[model samples]
Target: MKYEFIKSHEYLFPIEKMCKVLKVGCSSYFKWKSRPISKQLLLKEKIKQEIISIYFASKQRYGSPRITFELNVLGYKISRITVAKYMKEFGLRSKLSKKFKVTTNSKHSYLVVENVLDRNFEAKEPSKVWVSDITYIHTKEGFLYLTTIIDLYDRKIIGWSLNNGMSTKETSIAAWKMAVRNRKFDKGLIFHSDRGVQYANRKFAKMVESYGVIRSMSRKGNCWDNAVAESFFKSLKTELIYGNKLIKKEKMELVYVFKRKWTFS
Candidate 1:
């Protein structure tokens, strides 16, 4: 290991000095350097490059397990332990998830329905149950409010809208329209959200009622009723928006594109 270290840094420091500092003999270091690189060493180098590629491709959101799965999919025959070791050696780590602040304001006089879905996040078929929520992204100009409707069956973002304000029209209604356009609304389909004013407002409720959809609101002051939506926001903030300045719509658009690719790929 000392000789390998000396060889790796030889271009930056004198070999004799490194050998002296590491308490190794110059002759042994030279002899070790003259030997051909072993097959294991060559394989490790190749795996290192591949790990870096996969890490960046995931935007640094993939840890050892996912990276190991990707490597196996590519016929690399690598294990999670090896991937984790390499990641540790290279100081590569997945982005840590931060706690996201809830943006729901359930104090309105608007009517709210009981939790008919009742924390049953599972959906038997596509369009059977949908979850919606709003989150904000900070930019130089101001905050950009994002509203998303996800199909619970597949956990896909069926529709979304981005705006500078969190009004009912801009938030819930817009996202609902997009979701309606994208998927067939089954009769008695359940649309779930927190008792935020956007989702509780009579206008939005009537709009959803027009499509024969059942309205379900989270219990007052509780987020777990709509946990799926909150989890999606956490992933978005951790993987895309946290610790980054998104000043332009183009960047947000690019993020959306990457999100779709990551979700489907």
Candidate 2:
């Protein structure tokens, strides 16, 4: 206690004077200060810092296994078990997104194509054409719906929403609002999507039309009409959602993470 007090107030008062007042030997305090930190402790601290660095660098997306692999790649002699221990010590964890029990619920036989993009995926410029789609993600808790609006020119997700339901308000309208907020568009900008109920209903169409946006829907039987959105979801499944399960995460955080990745990728 005496040594601790002296160290705590060393900057504010002379160390020797504090030691003298506390009836402790100055030499004892000096000896403690001069002792070298153990090599193991030093190495432990270095590993801890590295763990923290990699955790946040991935937006908490990497778990112990990945972090351990990264450390080994960087020449750190560590094991996955040890990494997990330190992760627990620091209260670090990766967010999860799991479960695939269902598919999108857009099974109305509406063979409507207001303006057939006709597989013309190319966009002359940004905001001139935007494509939208929804895909399911499996979670231990339940299924999740990820709706995205991508500017075809850049193939970037300009707007997105993560939801537990496929309602128009939760899916298409929410995503379109975000897309408009994220990018400027003029009248007659073509907004293309599958003929899902969320995008087919009057509510969603009215929302898009209010902004002077043109609507385009995929044909009755062809999946290639909105290939841009389909391709994005396919890649997402193979790359991020195939084998490993993402621990369940908050819906909002998932949407934000998706937006950040596609916005800059």
Candidate of highest TM-score: 1
- Per-residue lDDT of model 2, residues 89-158, tens digit only: 8999886545444444458653445755767889878889988888887766877888989888888888
Misplaced by over 4 Å in model 1 are 1-50, 63-89, 96-102, 220-224, 243-246, 249-265
Runs of candidate 2 with Cα error greater than 4 angstroms are: 1-111
Reference-based lDDT, each prediction: 0.84, 0.80
- Write down the TM-score for model 1: 0.68
Best by lDDT: 1
Clashing pairs in 2: 96-246, 96-247, 97-246, 98-138, 98-139, 99-138, 99-139, 100-138
